[model samples]
Target chain A: MEKNQILSVAISGLLALGLAGTANAADNKPEMEKCFGIAKAGMNDCSGSKSSHSCAGQASKNNDPMDFVAVPKGTCNKIANGSLTDGGGVVKKAM
Target chain B: MPASKYTFPCVAGIGLRAPHYREVLETLPELGWVEVHSENFFGGGAPLHTLRKVREHYPVSLHGVGMGLASATPLDEKHLSDLSQLCNDIQPVAVSEHLCWNAATGFVINDLLPFPYTREALDHVTRRVTQVQEKLKRQLLVENLSSYISFSQSEMTEGDFLAELTQRSGCGILFDVENLYVNVRNLGVDAEAFIKTIPADAVKEYHLAGFSERDGCLVDTHNHPVYNEVWDLYEHVLKHLGPRPTLIEWDTDIPALPELLNEAAKAQLIIEQCHD
Candidate 1:
């Protein structure tokens, strides 16, 4: 093959591999949903709700409907007898 | 209900926190068992995966910090279910919660708070404990609280309250020696009297943690090493209650794995001496 053609083919192969890698990365991202009103004080996943404390086990109040933890994407609302807030729960708020 | 299949060894364990998870799992240190804050593993994924791995090498005890057993909010069912699921998953050697309230009418304080030791409160706590025991289908060890405040309407000492709760609810006691010391220092509780009041067999586990003094009040911070005074108190407890599964808990400002193991070694020495 011509040198330029060979170079173009190699670049195209690398570009295709890069795109496939990106798609695989996207596929690897686990589907997660935010479970709210279940975290005990100071036990929330992160500082998504309160202002006073910015770390785990630092929630200012218990069952702060605003504080949440990430669960499997669709399992939050399906938790039997689980408590959650509006807007499809805190996951959307967090996003 | 059948008793929990798991039994903790009468040796020294450590509170398994995040910072030490990797090293503890990798090195498999010479420890009795490890306890994790149940809430930390409630959501699943990496935390639960690590716990599963840790479970393979160690007998894990699910120490819950968020059950709010004394809360007046009718016990969060989801919370109980989540804990039940965790219990089924981990099958820990023991499960325990504090003898304090964290939620009340309309608000929940994340910190453990002292409640009035009234007959009404007793009834409330007993029912809640029974409910928890029913859900877990195993005896729950209730730990005494280290409080900074006391209610004016308290009708009984914390020790008496715990003893009665055990008798009425069929639960076990997780005697936290440091918490007793903190109460003695901050609330003027008589440590010896507290020890004498509790029934010995009821104490299935013991927690030894460090405390700090803030404005002359002792705080169960679990940051520093177990203090001399607390160790002295633990010796007294060992004499009365005999050796139990003692755990060295360090939550905040967590030290390296060796430092925690060293603390655990000290507890192991004390426990062995008691056994001898």
Candidate 2:
């Protein structure tokens, strides 16, 4: 085989490997869903049920049952004392 | 890597929230550009879909509210990765984050919180800013924060901190006029002094939002329209720093699409008057 042909084959192999690695990384990401009443004070992803506040980081109280955190979809209900519905569970005030 | 090729005209724009996405896209409003909080679209779904459609019509600036650049904790790799992916997908005209710490130790605060502006904090922020810029391959604009409280620790002013951060991190300034005004009223910060200290050339964008007062302290709430006082201050900014891409941000109780556009028009008029 020609030297150039060998070099081309090696480069193609590395490119294939890099592409596969990226695909694996993308596949590894867990499915995430917003879990309310899980976010601590100042930790909510965005505004909760409160109509007074318009955007993120406006939780007036710690773990206000309205606030939410992005957790693995199925895992939200599984987390100890975690509630998926806003204001459904006991409010865990921020420590 | 050379400061993302994306750029916006030196005009006024609006922060496109979820509620107005459909209207803005359908109507194709006449405006300079539009911005959205980066975190809102971090995940793929309707938000990203709407943003993609909006991008076809106007320039989009990805303004971040959760990067927490100065957080004492290490930079959030996952958050940075998500942002990088979004930037690649959207190819935003400009990207920005606040110069505040949202998380500390183990707790992550959703709001932009103030921190002591000491040399130690400056070093920490500079490193994080550089990391973000490298990841996005663009000049990330760092915005000033509106604080409800002040730290008594030894340090410099927020303006001085931002100036030095820009110098050290090769980042640009977002120049939130409303935030500066909030600080001026709530914290007694000198807005004019701040304008002088910052390098005007590095100010890539300006943010104009409304504030609400609580217990004699002004809160950076975007529900109301830009007040006359903030507009007056904006004129001073345009005069001193020159006109840049300005945005009207109304997050709380966002009114109709026309109202938002009207606010942008007001900013546009001011921007035009400055040039004339």
Candidate 3:
């Protein structure tokens, strides 16, 4: 086939993929919280405010104030020192 | 024609990172070819889509950093399979991995930690390279690593190990010139001997990058432009090994596309001079 024909196929494929992605997003999306000040060393979700973990799971100590542990939306506050904010404020985003 | 028909052009290219993807695709600059960290595109959404677009204009080389070929632990089958899938998708001009290890035992180290140049390590790495080659059904270019330390336990020099590795595994060499420079400066590696020991014919590519110095050790940080000393060293390498597809690798603090192309131009000029 010619160039335009090949491109049409690719365009159609991308459209279908995009549509499927939209449907999946409408169906389900995970809601987790970046609960700061609760992650044990080496178990943080990602690099912290101070970058305790450059690579994932490279944190050096337990409950590092800078590190975070991503938890369920409503579950962060119940755990001690677990703040939804980077450095916790009273105004929290919707769970 | 299929993209698979493209081969890495013997000129200068840059390490295509995420930051400049938009600009590169928009401008479609005249790059000799582009190399990318294989792990970065494994996710296969926007990254892979952009790469497909990039492949239309340039020959792409899939350079892997996480294979951990010399790692003592068993090979990561999943990683190999992902790479094979990527090769199938992209039909890259060349597929290469570093001659270093990242995983050991239960932990996965993010950095390309060095290993001893022992006979045992060679045998292990050779077997792993053969396995990767078989799986990919293509020749894999194993890059020499930049190390700050050396092992005194046993065995030969790195160049010797790489020479034997190529002979045994039927693989090619991605000689990172700056890595050798770092070893020479930091660990007192013999530069002339290294230049001589690597079978020139086995060398399929060359890498030039700038390094950072902390205290006294030279770190293989590909952020800055190719240093004057490294350019001098590369000139020496070209006199011996001749020229191949050379790359300008800048991972951090990536400048604009023109700046990168300017760096590539320097390599292109040197490559042209060497050709003359």
Per-prediction TM-score, chain B alone: 0.97, 0.97, 0.97
lDDT of 1 by residue, B1-276 (tens): 122236678888898776566567667777788888888778677667778878888889998877887787889899899999999999999999988877988998876777899999999999999999999999999999888899999999999999999999999999999888888888899998999999999999999988777658676778789999889889989998899989998876778789999999999899999988
Cα error, candidate 1, residue B203 (Å): 0.3
How good is chain A of candidate 3, measured by TM-score? Answer: 0.28
- What is each model's TM-score for chain A? 0.23, 0.23, 0.28
In candidate 3, what are the lDDT values of residues A1-95, reduced to their tens digit? 99999999988887887788764466565433232122224544422212111111111224555556665676555666465554556546645
- How good is the docking of model 3, by CAPRI class? incorrect
For residues B119-190, write the lDDT of model 2, one tens digit per residue.
Answer: 999989999999999999989999988888889994899999999999999999999999889889988999
lDDT of 2 by residue, A10-76 (tens): 8888778768876445656543323212222453443332222123324132454555665556646
DockQ, candidate no. 1 = 0.04
Please report the candidate that would top DockQ against the real structure: 2
Model 1 clashing-pair count: 3
lDDT of 3 by residue, B120-217 (tens): 99899999999999999999999998887888874899999999999999999999999999999999999999999999999999998877887687
Put down candidate 1 lDDT per residue, A35-93, tens digits, no spaces.
Answer: 22222245545222222210122212235455566555665566653444443442533
In candidate 2, list every pair of residues with a backbone clash.
A42-B109, A42-B110
Clashing pairs in 1: A42-A57, A42-A58, A42-A59
List the RMSD of every prediction in angstroms: 12.8, 11.1, 11.0
